[model samples]
Target chain A: MTEILFYSLSIIAIATSLLMIFHKNAMYSVLFLLACFFSIAGLFVMLNAQFLAVVHIIVYAGAIMVLFLYVIMFLNMSTPITIRKSKLVMFAAVLTGLMMAFLLVVSVWQTQAFGQHPEIVDQNIGLAKTLGKVLFNEYLIPFELTSILFISSMVGVVIFNKKEVEDE
Target chain B: MNELINLKDQLRIIPLEHYVFLCIILFSIGVMGVLLRRNMIIVFLSIELMLNSINLLAVTFSVYHNDASGQAFVFFVMVVAAAEVAVGLAMLVLIFRNIKSVDINALNHLKW
Candidate 1:
């Protein structure tokens, strides 16, 4: 059952993500990316990280993607912008990505450290209560620091969007 | 106890390697998206995809090691990603206001 769920979700995620990347229209790409995020959330649930899954949906699909759509609409990108890149650059970019993937896969495959452990120690570590405890206790400092980061980023946004008053 | 066992059994059905490979594919797709797309928004979307793939890997390892730290770290990553998108979009809007284009190539010359 879990196998079925995993495979289906993985397929959906990869397909939608590829569609999101290759789609010409920015609006369609955003929608496709939204679908990809949903599938990733499903995968998170299958991995027993229910809380992370929920938060992923809320932060990513809810907040970020909406921001993306708003920006896209705000820019009024009705006409698809044409980017004329030479075919060689496109080929090199694809080759670079493939090489990176190949290297990562090879490295991961060679590392036997993670291969020996098939047994999960605690199945409930992903539960919110446990995660919350860990967050508030051991991760307390970093958790609080994120608020500072948020404040700074918020300030940065406001400042960046501030109107420039011209001197007469 | 029974539910815990069931959860373990369900998780065991899929190996950790599978998740790793899945993340790798997703990450590669993200890299390609960033590389191949000229639209600044799509590039940002691709970056999000890459971050998410890493988050999934972290959660997989966290579960494998019975550690909640990975999930906590993923939480921090999401926070950072959120803040990044906000600022990035704001900058993007500013750029658009100046040049009226989001094509990455449009800003090739910084003097614009």
Candidate 2:
């Protein structure tokens, strides 16, 4: 059952991600990207990461996607004529992909013997309570710093837009 | 026949390998998107895909270990992802306003 679910969700995730890249319209691409993000969030749920799944939907689908759509609308970008990559860059990208694949294979092979095989994921472990304890206990500093980071980003956005308005 | 039945029963459980495989597929798609697309926003979207793929893996491991800490980290990641998209898209908007396009290939003015 989980295997079937994994494959089906994987197909949706991959297909939407492809559409996101190939779509000519920036609006359409972002929309497809939202679908991709949501499908990934579904995969998270199947992995018993329900908290992350919710956060994925809230953050990526809700917040990030909206920002992208707003930028698209604000720019009022007409359909892109063409977005091209240079041959040299394309070659480099392919080479990098192959190298990364090789490295991944090597690392997995090296670590295979040392690591214990993982069991079935725990299903009853997710909900907010467990997450809260861990966040407030082990990862307290990073949690606090994430807020500071978000505030700085908000400040940056204001500064950038303000500069734009001033120039105009 | 009993052994076969027991084996089938065990197979019904969701294994960690399936999650790992899904993560690999998503990560590859993201890599392809980042490498092939010239639009900066799409590139960022692809980056998000890659991040989400890793998050999926993290969550899978967390569950396998019966620990919630991994999910907690994912929350932080999502927060950063939101901030990243906000700032990234804003920059893209400013760029489009000035240049009248979102193609990264045309960004040669800052190449000095």
Candidate 3:
């Protein structure tokens, strides 16, 4: 059952991402990306990262996607007019990405024996309270610093929008 | 609770190789989008895809090793990603306002 679920979810994730790449309309592409994000959340759940799975949906599909849609709409960008790079550039991009993917596949296949075989993960690892403990205990410095980073980003946003403040 | 463990056991039946390959393929798609697309928003979206793929890989290993630290790091990745996309889109908005377009190719004024 898990195998079937993993296979289907992965296929959904891959297909939606492909649609995002090929869609000419930015809105449609964004929508496809949202589907891809949700499918990834499902994969996370399968991986026993239940907390990350929920947070993934809340952050990526819920908050970030809304922001993406808002910006795309606000800008009112229509279909891009084929910002035509040469065929060589397109071929190069495809070739390089495919080469990287092939390399990754070959390496992953060869290195499978190095790691111990998979087993049942601990339930405590994936829940919020368990992660909360680790976050506050082992990762306290980075946890606190994330807040500082968040604050700086907020300030950066305000600074960037300063022109609009002046205009209004 | 026993049933849940059974499910987790079943999850392990799917080889880790499949997970790694899936992530790499998705990551490659992201790379392709970033390299080929001229639209800044799509490029940003592709970047998020790449990050998501990495987060997936991290969580996979975390679970396979019976560890929690990797999942915690995934949370951090999401937080930083949110901040990045927010600031990046805001800057994109400012650029659009000035140049009246979002095509990245249009921003060549800095070139002498």
Best by lDDT: 1
How does each model score on lDDT? 0.88, 0.74, 0.87
TM-score for the A-chain in each candidate structure:
0.92, 0.84, 0.91
Per-residue lDDT over B15-93 for candidate 2, one digit per residue giving the tens place of the 0 to 100 score: 5555676677677767876887788877888898888888887877776677788788778777887888888887888
Model 1 TM-score (2 dp) = 0.94
Instruction: Give the Å shift of residue B73 in candidate 3.
Output: 0.8
User: Rounded to one decimal, what is candidate 3's iRMSD?
Assistant: 1.8
Give the total clashing residue pairs for model 1: 0
By the DockQ metric, which is better: model 2 or model 3? 3
Q: What is the DockQ of candidate 1?
A: 0.69
- TM-scores of the models, in the given order? 0.94, 0.85, 0.94
C-alpha lDDT of residue B28 in model 2: 72
lDDT (10s digit) by residue, model 2, range A80-168: 74545578876776566556656665565555552454445344566677777888899999999998998999999999999999999
Instruction: Encode model 3's per-residue lDDT on A1-168: one tens digit a residue.
Output: 677778999999999999898788888889999999999999887766788889999999899999999998888785554634788888888888899999988888888473566455576688889899998999999999999998999999999899687987
TM-score of 2: 0.85
**For model 1, what is the error of residue B40's alpha carbon versus the real structure, in angstroms, after optimal superposition?**
0.3
